[model samples]
Target: MEKPRKTAIFSQVPTLEEPRIDANILIRLLQVAIDRDFEAAEVALLKTLIQDPCLNFQAVADKTGYQMYYLRGQVGPRLWADFTEVFGRSYGAEIGKRNFGDFIHCFLEKLSLMPNSFLQQDLEQHQIAQIFEPGEGEWAIAPSESWFYGRSKELDSLGKLLSQYRLVTLIGDVGVGKTALAARWTERFGAKSFDRVIWKSIAHAPEPDILLNELLQEFEVKELPQKLSEKMSVLMQIIKRQRCLIVLDSAESLIRTTAITALDPYTSPDYGRMIRFFAEEPHQSSLLFISRRRFNDVLRLSRANRAAATMRLEGLQPKEAQRIFEAHGLKNSSDWQRLIQIYAGNPQYLISISEYIQTVFSGSVQEFLRCDTVIVPDIVCQEYITQIQEINAEHRALLFHLAALKDPVHFDQLVVNLATSMKSQSALIKALNDLTEMNLVEKQQNNAILFGLNPIVKKVILSFPFIGGS
Candidate 1:
């Protein structure tokens, strides 16, 4: 015996008494949400998808007489893909009938009221209110402050990115304020925009499994996924459920020193995969990467996607640097300008000098400038020295030559200057590229790729006794 054929005449319809609204209204809203062409059959299919008490696609296919192939392959994917595009993430598995009710509920509540809307109830304000308050997952976020300055532009830019993009990398030299900027921005814009803000600092570049397990714990996942891919999927599911802001500070700790200049993925395999997953997957959440160096994979992705971006923090402006001086009660505002120029307005350097003046010179800005020809915080100088020692002698020589130059030099000029003393043009180019990535050398604004050393970096190099004093 064969099974009997089912037709639209036999399809079941429900009244308002059974549920909240007519199935037709839901089908119309969904069509508007997805911006799709729905014929009578597709409408019937959607009615089954939403109104069926079982919430089972396969069972509905059997009862409605529509081929499972069309329902599963053609209509289902289109609907979900549109949802992901509109909502910026997926709420359920790609193939499953699970989460249908939650999806309906969220859409009904979250979406703007459409014309001819027949919603029985609007979205609850409590759901929107919950995102602004700190939740269980906020233990990892850093505290915000009131004294942060000169980063309003950066904060606004990050605000736009978090709304539109999934991954953002904040790159700068150490003490250039990457961490502070990220933390401050989170407090200003992120605190209200996201439901959970989790901050983690990579102290020693732990293995992927360890980090993954830790993150799962933070999410309070009781039954952890066995595989890395499964873990990523589960994490993304949580992101879809609630707005999340994940801040990973000191991201450069995970990249091998030698690999920093290489045009390859980050040296840490697990972290590399994480970056790729964040960039490629659809999620409403944003990941903030604060690092001294840029991840090549992230740079590549950001270049290709406006939704992913990199914000390279530079030195503070003169007016902004003045606040640091005033906070220390330092006098001689004009002399402070000279110090700012020498340090290129780096807050760490200014603070260190201010403390030194307060203790030894009675906050005399002139006396501080008179004694220090190469002014920098001792810690910053040590860091610069360490970074310089990482490269070979040829790269070191190129950096010395760059520091010695009065203005930015073109590649050909650089080659000519180093013809007898330095390595070949290719080696010099490679070294220059490496130095630029490390934030020691910067390209000048010209059609030709002219390169120059950072002012503070040059001062530090000149101050090296063995390198011949300025």
Candidate 2:
């Protein structure tokens, strides 16, 4: 699989490869107020508009206003009638009562700030001013629109986890769609039930003290006591009263190709304090810990042993993959199967390749079946990898090799190839197990280890100049 020619096009000086979008396509994001339950959609729409005012289209604004006034939160048919009247054009039958969800989705999508050369020629060239830059919305209630595709089961599982326990551990690898699942769950379930949902990514492994301080900041509490014990006391008191759902992302120190380094310094004793705070304090609270590492590191503290439900995401199924393509407006049953065979259910990779085939490659879904192209490792994966500073060169090198091999390799084969990298067999097993927990790889009975290789990943890997590039 060679890297997608599109990536190469992007790499070349922009003047060299043509851009795909117009310069003046910055229509404001739709701000149709919805039932308060749809807060996530409203906030996201508002932020998109504020950040990319160039997308502010008069027609879109009018429709959004109508939605705020009349239609239920999601897009509906009446909006279509308004669209025809305002824009002098109408598409999609029965506009008065069509799915507002789809309309709002398409509307918001068109507002993306894609600054490409091709787009420049299509529209006008004006800068999106930063004076009113958007801020990160409160813990994400709605998963990004991509999750709206085909993942109902995963979202259902998440709702169950939330119902059973206060602490949930969303364990999955890069691009496995853990965050998306949580977002969907929070939107559908939280909107109807929970009092509040707070999303906080523990950016990196900083000293426990510094990390704890930031956690307190999320609560808007200033001037903490210097003594660790006092701060811990204050934190617990505040948490006990609120019915809040907390997501602590990347709680461990398992660095990967996509994780960023943090600046936290927790002494062994303080580490105990930190663990106790999460596990023992906040007796009536619920929390979720999302990370790439397996449970051993988190569970080792003993505090987490009595709490926390776990949800590990897997690759998509063929049916779900097909559903995603259809939602994206593709209608080829045969090609859908081909896509599943190639991508093996990795959502981000699937979406990336799909985008390439659509907007960049002339909208022919079949082109993907006929060609081999590598895409970026997904924004999620790339962001996760940048957080790892402790993953040294040797371990990283071993992972690179392991990623190259097909899964279910016997332990003997792995050791023959990677034993030299580690000091002993125990260490190797731990390392491999860590990857498994990360959802980056899998292991099974009979001492066999498997690596993550969905169709899109394999395609991307093969596209690279080197072998096993994914």
Top model by TM-score, which number?
1
Local accuracy by lDDT, each model: 0.67, 0.49
In Å, residue 327's CA in model 1 sits off its true spot by 1.4
lDDT of 1 at 393: 67
Off by over 4 Å in 1: 1-138, 143-147, 259-263, 403-408, 417-423, 445-450, 459-470
Cα TM-score per model: 0.64, 0.60
RMSD (Å) per prediction: 22.8, 15.3
Best by lDDT: 1
Candidate 1 residue lDDT tens string, 1-470: 32212112112223323555466756654554444557665775767766643333444566678765687678777765655455423221222333344355434433322222322333232332222233444433353322345878877877887788899888988677777677767645665899887877774677777777777777899999889888888888988888888888878777765543464445557777888887788888888888887777877888787557887888789888888777667778889888887777777777667766765676788887788666667778888887776556677778889898889998889889999766588778777877787888988776777888876788888888353322
Which residue pairs collide in model 1, if any?
none
Give the Cα-based TM-score of candidate 1 against the true structure: 0.64
